[model samples]
Target: MKIKVNSEACIGCGACEQIAKDLFEIGDEGVSKAKVSEVPEDKKAMAQEAIDGCPTGAIQGEE
Candidate 1:
């Protein structure tokens, strides 16, 4: 599985980073983006949590 962050949609809220620091971070003018393209097996659940927790629905997941 993989994760993608919509730069336009992100508001730099940092929720993803807070929820899954290993998988996400604030970057590119302070937008929250995925730290890795492919989600690690152990981090997958937290990645989904970050996606679901994002207020703007900016994080997208790909299998």
Candidate 2:
């Protein structure tokens, strides 16, 4: 699975960070964005939860 983040829609709420700090982070611009790392299968659930927790619907799964 691939995760996509809409930078324009993100509010940097840190919900994704709370769910999966390894996968997401708040950038200097304060937008919730993905970190530069490979996502493990164990953290997939948390990643999905983060995507769901995004209030602006800025995150999505690609395939």
Candidate 3:
């Protein structure tokens, strides 16, 4: 599974980070962005939660 972030849709909220800090992070500009971390298949559920929990709907899955 690959995580994709729509930077344009992100509103700098830390919701995703709160849900999955290992998979996401606040960028230098303070926007919520995908962290350069590996996500195991078992963590897909948590990742999905983070994606769905994003208030700005900025996160998605590639497959």
Candidate 2 lDDT over 1-63, as tens digits, reads 567778999988888888888888888998877873446778788888988889999987654
> Distance (Å) between predicted and true CA of 47, model 1?
0.4
Ranking by lDDT: 1, 3, 2
TM-score of each: 0.95, 0.85, 0.87
lDDT of each: 0.93, 0.81, 0.83
| Candidate 2 vs 3: which has more lDDT | 3
TM value for model 3: 0.87
Off by over 4 Å in 3: none
lDDT of 3 by residue, 1-63 (tens): 788788889998798888888889898987877774456888889899998898877887766
For residue 63, model 1's alpha carbon misses the true position, in angstroms, by 1.2
Report the C-alpha displacement of residue 33, candidate 3, in angstroms: 1.7
Off by over 4 Å in 1: none
Number of the top-ranking candidate, with lDDT as the measure: 1
- What lDDT tens digits, residue by residue, belong to model 1 across residues 5-60? 99999999899999999999998699987889999899989998999999999999
